[model samples]
Target: MRAFREDESRRNAPLTAENATRVREAMRGISFAGTPPHWAELIAENNWMDRLHGVGQSSSRS
Candidate 1:
């Protein structure tokens, strides 16, 4: 997760004109799945705390 955050920050950093053009070109062919189709319903039906902290009932256990 830390590595993912670092990579996201690096991707969002300001780019030089040449780099910006290259980045734009690179994104042209990209296709994003954009959150799963059932994401909202799944989230609504599930307990987030359980998902986020496993099956433990307390922070101390985590």
Candidate 2:
């Protein structure tokens, strides 16, 4: 997600419509596969369904 971390000035700036579109374009076609990096953490409680589908806990803004 380091790539998603906007520069300090940009992050502090207002999220205008144009900026939102830019973010969407930047994220397009990106996908995560294979083992997660060591810095990743599983925030959700252990569950069977997720395990069955290979889904895992994730943290995100509320």
Candidate 3:
């Protein structure tokens, strides 16, 4: 998770920052076949859902 935040914050470093961006793009709108019920609550509690959807997020890139 720390690595994810690092990549998110360092968009100018293409090699490092692209990892999280690519992963997030791939995972967007994807639901695992057998996801556990508790996972939804946990993700929402941590505000991960917004990250996945890129909601209300800011980017250094214009």
Candidate 4:
């Protein structure tokens, strides 16, 4: 998403110009090792998942 890329670029802002470009490129190329976890797996692992789920549900209604 554009917003995600923008946020990632902003996070690279503290680095030197070359370092920032490298950081952004590295982040853009992210690939999970092994299979990606499912949403239910995420919910089971994280205590904050309930809070996040509620926020997701609320956002969908709006």
Candidate 5:
């Protein structure tokens, strides 16, 4: 998540519109595979069902 935050910061930094778009695209392709380096607390709980089926978590609220 730290990497994602850093990428987000870089994307938001002052830059040409074209450059910003490229950074945004690059960040969109970034993924966190395997075990994370740190055990940071997740803001939302995750279920193994989604992970097993390769489906990402939905943003829907109960």
Candidate 6:
């Protein structure tokens, strides 16, 4: 998930895009209401799913 965070190009992409819609769906009600290093993982993980077309990262950086 952290890997995705570093991939700023994708991370900064609009959440209203199609892929972002899919990401939000997978998140299934997870709130995007918080600060970094906290909501960071949730947003990154969801974004990662969208980026890879459903594939998840094997490891996360700390």
Best by TM-score: 2
The better-scoring model by TM-score among 1 and 2 is 2
Residue 45 local lDDT, model 1 = 39
What's the lDDT of the predicted structure labeled candidate 6? 0.57
Q: Model 5: residues >4 Å from true position, as ranges? A: 1-13, 34-62
Q: lDDT for each of the candidates?
A: 0.60, 0.53, 0.58, 0.63, 0.55, 0.57
Considering TM-score, which of the candidate structures 1 and 4 is the better prediction for this target? 1
Model 1 C-alpha lDDT per residue in residues 1-62, reported as the tens digit of each score: 99999999987655555655576589789987777576656675357756634422232332
List TM-scores for all candidates, in order.
Answer: 0.32, 0.38, 0.32, 0.28, 0.33, 0.26
Candidate 2 has a TM-score of: 0.38
- Give the per-residue lDDT digits (tens) of candidate 3, residues 1-62: 99998987776443334555676688797886875687567555457756644532333232
For the record, the alpha-carbon RMSD of candidate 4 to the native fold, in angstroms, is: 13.3
Query: How far out, in Å, is residue 12 in model 1?
Result: 7.8
Looking at model 6, residue 23 earns an lDDT score of 73
User: What is the lDDT ranking, best to worst?
Assistant: 4, 1, 3, 6, 5, 2
lDDT at position 13, candidate 3 = 46
Residue-level lDDT for 13 in candidate 2: 56
List of clashing residue pairs for candidate 3: none
Prediction 5 TM-score vs. true: 0.33
Q: Model 4, range 1-62, lDDT digits (tens) per residue?
A: 99999999986544455654575588788877986567746555467767756544554454
Better of 4 and 5 by lDDT: 4
> What's the residue-level lDDT of 36 in candidate 5?
62
Q: Which structure is stronger by lDDT: 1 or 5?
A: 1
What alpha-carbon RMSD in Å does predicted model 3 have with respect to the real structure?
7.2
Residue-wise C-alpha lDDT for candidate 6, range 8-54, written one tens digit per residue: 87665445455555875888877665565755576667676686563
How far does residue 48 in candidate 4 sit from its true spot (Å)?
Answer: 18
Q: What is the lDDT of residue 18 in candidate 1?
A: 64
